[model samples]
Target: MQTFVTEAVDWPDTAPALRERVRALVAEHGERDQVRRANSWTKPDPQFSRKLGKAGLLGMTWPKEYGGHERSQLERYVAIEELLAAGAPVGAHWIADRQSGPLLLRLGNEELKRRWVPAIARGEAFACIGLSEPGSGSDLASVRTAARRDGDGWVLDGQKVWTTGAHVSHFMIALVRTEAGSERQKGLSQLVVPMDTPGVTVKPIVDLTGAHEFNEVFFDQVRLPGSALLGTEGEGWKQATAELSLERSGPERYLSSMVLFLELVRHASVHRNPELDMLVGRLAAEAWTLRLMSASVAAKLARGEDPALEATMVKDLGNSYEQAIPQLVQAAVDFGSPDNEVLRAVCFYLLQVSPSFSLRGGTREIVKGIIARGLGLR
Candidate 1:
């Protein structure tokens, strides 16, 4: 792994300026009604995602040459925090805007950077990550999808399960094996597979909550030009590890549970009990700590460093925190007071949805394994 040092880059002098700018955009264009009614895990509106692109909020942290606004990652962090806190329906462009664009910017060829970044920043094109496979959940290197060099391009064949937004996405940046049956983490390659291609098939997977948020994608003899490869052909493991650090250590980690948290607060503020007060205080403190840790990782990303270990730490802790929110809320509601219908409804929705919070991005067990390995304990 290459080491990139993170010296303190000057935190933007007027950080509030960027925050207010994004907030103003959110006020004008944020999908407030839909977001409040439906969590972003459900399908998102494409037009709203395009509006974010036009506002220059999608790829705010990349270089200007590639259609990014060249804003600091911390500024982008502020934008994301506000979006998620408000429960904005950023799901349509979330995977692309957050991780794929940045991954392409960092590891993609110049042509890919020139081609995809502008479209992504403009929100005209959308993408999703294809890291999870049928049998391999968080062990990305265990993917069985194979890409064989054919003529001047690659022919791909395999199935990817639990792929988020594959049904709606225009492209899927997939991790497939380029070499046959290599050891634990070798010979895997990342390829950009267009969703509309001939051999690509996407079948939606309905979750227990009755939400069609994920898909089982099949690629059979799917051929792509050599340009489909993101980086080198046999470097998928390193590339994915580096890219996932960016994916796992963001505001989304803490924000998924925010809707339920806010509803709980709304209920608690009026039906005041000492236990509810203490619970809110404790949750507030945890939220603050998660924010600082996420910010630290963002600062590292801004400096082009892959804080892989730190990112694992953040995700592991954040998942634990997120998973606990619903249980904690239920405990609070059960002990003291009469359950408000709205609060009970929100809690029920969140409880049903909480399992995926740990599964998505990376599973808790996977994150802990990474942390252990990083600490030389593996």
Candidate 2:
């Protein structure tokens, strides 16, 4: 693959101070029990989100004129790493804070930015991405959702599967075909549709872990005003391509499985086996590498460059590490009894959830295809 690492911007001098501030905030509200009690992998507590907003932690990259702190992306990244590492309930504001807000800032009309950016930064508004449809894993061009231009708006009709936070989000950044598909990436457009729009419905999808995180959202001739469209018509494919890089590379990629890693490492240290120690060392090294790769992407993004291929590499490798945690840990940690409820429960939870790490955001096959295309090997 064409290595897409832009010249690394010097780590912002402000990064350490911001990291310390975020770390302090985490220390104040951080609790393992609270994290365990959080129900959905995709939904976050509204109260927690408000608290984050009050702490001036949201909208780290937007301009100050828009109620943002105007911090560099690297600083924003450090804040996210601290939040995810501490297992904070950031799900409610995650999509809005990370992808939707930044996207709107880029392509939204002035009215849209003025109306939504402050609310998003304040955590009073939340958003979700409505990109995937049934059997359309990363094949965004194949989406069947159709939105026909009406007199002053558009009528949308389609279903989106595995839509995280769809049930509770105030808005969804939806992709739909605005024209016939012959143009390939053309003829596609993105719209910011309110979840409360008439004819919209969200149904929960329970996973093996009994988590109600993903959902199937249906739009039945939903009427949206012209203002709801995000960017110029037929520009969604380009917009979404850039946005996926934001999704694919980040602290969330590796930190989701960190609690499990800590548990496994603790078990190994107590048992003190050479094999387990070696494996832990290797995993830690990989984790550090992912951090460096992610940091490089953050630096590039800060410089107004999109390092899409580099971000995909981080996601691909980072997610593999996430999935491997349960298997490798399972092999290393042998409970005295296979039927031991404590050990069995942890094992079952990790195994059931590991599959989701690779599936969400983008699948392994889809990521590899992107990498291949970058290399001109396809």
Candidate 3:
């Protein structure tokens, strides 16, 4: 019998000062009520992103040569935790700072890194993931997007669906099949495809929330220079698999409804409802525990370790807890004293959008399968 355990983490003493700095920065974004910044990582706002970049809060872990501050990943977490908790608008730089920039620093060649990493760190260029497809939702190995080798470049001709922010992004770190006859997960290669390349089209995909956070991007004989290839040929599967550690385990996994959580607490306090206050306390405990679990995962990633099973665990359980926040808020308000117009509006919006918490990153079923495999149950 395998026993799963999460070791307790001792946060660095510097964390308090770092959090205060980020808190002061977040305070500058004032009037969160007007913006509704919940889940703002998926809601792009270039101006806000640029401000974060100028503040030197985006790329906290990378080398200073590429416009980074070379700060520890824990400090980065401090800044991001404060940003997400305050519902700051960070969507524009979220993907670039979180995944793409790091992926480039790890895999890209000198020229490729020099060209994109600085701009990414500066929040000058935006990016979107081109992994999911119309027919291949979570089964990424079955992606149908193909990139055929041309004389000195590649001609990509396929469609990538459910690409978040593709319509507004300047680039896509796409995974395409380079070897036509190769089987699943083989012959796959990662490429940096410029969105402005001719024959590339982006069709917006609106979700149930009446928001356009997804897009179906089509490549009709789109051409990319040979340098666009990231890492090595036929190695994209490995690169992509390794890259998901950040996507699945970060603070974003649990903070999707943080704004709503804060608002719910404020409403409960105003009414002095014991039941609602109890729910808030329970939820706060859950968030604190999950943060420690997630911080453990971050520590591993900082050391260049994947910790796949641990990251998957954080995402699966954290998303469930995040999804429940808005539901609990709605129930609390419905059963007790109602909230004012502002709190009610936040509750309704989070209630509408929280369903996606489990969908993105990876579904609960998919993640649990990984956990089962890691525990030798598969």
In terms of TM-score, the best-performing candidate is 3
| TM-score versus the correct structure, for each prediction | 0.91, 0.92, 0.95
Top lDDT model: 3
lDDT per residue for candidate 1 within 65-162, as digits (tens), equals 88889877777888888777777778888888888998898788887788788998988778878888877876566788899999899999999988
Q: How accurate is candidate 2 locally (lDDT)?
A: 0.80
lDDT of 2 by residue, 122-174 (tens): 88899989889995767778888889989998999999998988877999999
TM-score: which is higher, 1 or 2? Answer: 2
Which digits, one per residue and each the tens of the lDDT, describe model 3 over residues 235-305? Answer: 99999988887889888899888878877777777778789879989999999988998888877777777
For candidate 1, report its TM-score: 0.91
Q: Cα lDDT for residue 326, model 1? A: 80
Q: How does each model score on lDDT?
A: 0.80, 0.80, 0.84
